[model samples]
Every structure is written in C-alpha cells, then in structure tokens.
Target: MLDWTTVLVIVLMAASTYATRVVGFVVLRDRTLSPRMQAIMQNVPGCVLISVIAPAFVSSRPADLLGLAVTLAAAMRLSLLPTVVIGVVATGLLRHFVG
Candidate 1:
C-alpha cells in the first residue's frame, strides 16, 4: 500500500519548506524589521489560520459550523495553546457524534 514515489515527493516538499524558512531567517538575521512590519509579521500566522478555516464558515455540515463557533469562542477568551486544544477536541467530538 505504500508508494515510495509519493513518500519521496512528500519528503522533498517538507525539506524545501523547511529550507525556505531557514533561508529567510539567515537572510534577515542582521536586518531589523520596522515596528509596523514586525507587528504585521506577528499576525501572519493567525491570518493564515483564518484563511485555512474560512471555508468551514460556509460549510453545510452542522459539525463544521458549530466547531468553528466553538473555536471562535475559545479564541476570544483563551490563550492560543488552550484555544487550539479546546477547538480540536470540540471539533473532533462534534464530528464523531454528529456525523
């Protein structure tokens, strides 16, 4: 069942992604970002997270929408780690029980 070619491609993709991150750090090591740009960089991860889950907002599945609601509520009141944990658990339970 294991495809060696697919595995190789995945490994290469992972390596390339990691390489890019390292390269970016190495290139910017001596440079200081402007305060505004630093603030923007800090929000990039959250923006990426929202973009990833944006489709769930319009999903027809009750589990998806409810999970997103629970995630939003958790995000509002909790720190990132706890919010992520609560969201994952809530979504998994909702999907398993409701689907």
Candidate 2:
C-alpha cells in the first residue's frame, strides 16, 4: 500500500542515519583525541540531554511541568530510577484525572 516516493524517503532516512553513526565510529577509530577534543567529548552527554529536555520543559502543560519538576528534583538528589518513576507516575496520574 506504500507509494514509491514514501518508501524511497524512508529508505534514505534509515541509510542516512546509519551512515552518520558509522562515519563517526570510522573517523574516531584510530585518532588520539587532544585535550580540547576530550573536553568536548566529556560535555557531549550533558549537551545532548539538555537539548532534549529543554524543549519539552518549555512546551509542556502544567501537569507535565509538575512531573518535570519532580523529576528534576529527584535527579538533583542523584536518584535516577526514582526520578524516572516519579515522572512517569505523576504524568500518568495527572493525565488520567485531569485530561
């Protein structure tokens, strides 16, 4: 039931994503990272996390905002699993009762 253009687009997207990941690995395989490069790499995870979280927090509704707040507090306390649990439960409960 799929059209040719749609299928081609999907295939190209998958291939592009795969190629990007593979290229990163190939490019870094034999390289010794300099101090600046190492520092950049060290910040990558935090940067990626902030990029994902920032938009969600900014665009979320009040209930989701509450859940995000709870999650952030738990995360600050270094309780990752509890943060995730609280976020999920708070969001689910709010959506169920309010929305």
Candidate 3:
C-alpha cells in the first residue's frame, strides 16, 4: 500500500539511523575511554530506561502502577533478565485482568 515516495522516505530514515549507530561505533573503535567516560557510558542505559519508564508509570492506572512498583522492586533485587520478565508479565497480566 505504500507509494514510491513513502517507501523512499522509510528507507532513507532507516539508513540514517543505521549510519548514526555505525558512526558511533566506528568513531569509538580506535579510542580508549577514561574511567570517568566509562562510568558515564555505564550510566547511560539506566538513565535512558528511567526516562522511558518513569512517564509510563506516572500516567498508568492504579493496577498498572502497582505492577510497575513490583517490577522496580524486583529489578532492584534481582538480575536484569528476570526483572524484565517479571515486569513484562506483571504488566500484561494486570492490564488484561483490570481492563
């Protein structure tokens, strides 16, 4: 159902995103980061995650908010994979039953 212009635009966007990611890797490949830089890099993922999840939790209903709380507690106490699984399953179950 896509026209040629739409397909071209989508392809260009995908290529642009891929190019930026590749540029970051390539630029960093030959350099060694300092301890401070490494710490910053380590914190990036968590910061990004909080940026994404915080708003969702704030806007969610009571049951969804409860699931988010449980998920956050599990994440703090457990490993990443288990935390993600618990969060996803809890959210899905709560939304399904509550809605």
Maximum-TM-score candidate: 1
Q: Name the Cα RMSD for model 2.
A: 5.1
**TM of each candidate vs. truth:** 0.78, 0.55, 0.69
lDDT: which is higher, 1 or 3? 1
Whole-model lDDT per candidate: 0.88, 0.74, 0.81
Question: Per-residue lDDT tens digits of candidate 1, residues 21-65?
Answer: 899789889999999989997887688678867899889999988
Count clashing residue pairs per candidate. Answer: 0, 0, 0
Better of 2 and 3 by TM-score: 3
Clashes of 2: 0
lDDT of 2 at 10: 97
- Residue pairs with colliding backbones in model 3 are none
Off by over 4 Å in 2: 1-19, 79-94
Q: In model 2, what lDDT does residue 94 have?
A: 77
Candidate 2 residue pairs in backbone clash: none
lDDT per residue as tens, model 3, 6-94:
99999999999799879988999999999999999787767756775686567648767877887899978987668778887897888
Greater-TM-score candidate between 1 and 2: 1
For candidate 3, give the lDDT. Answer: 0.81
User: Which is the leading candidate under lDDT?
Assistant: 1
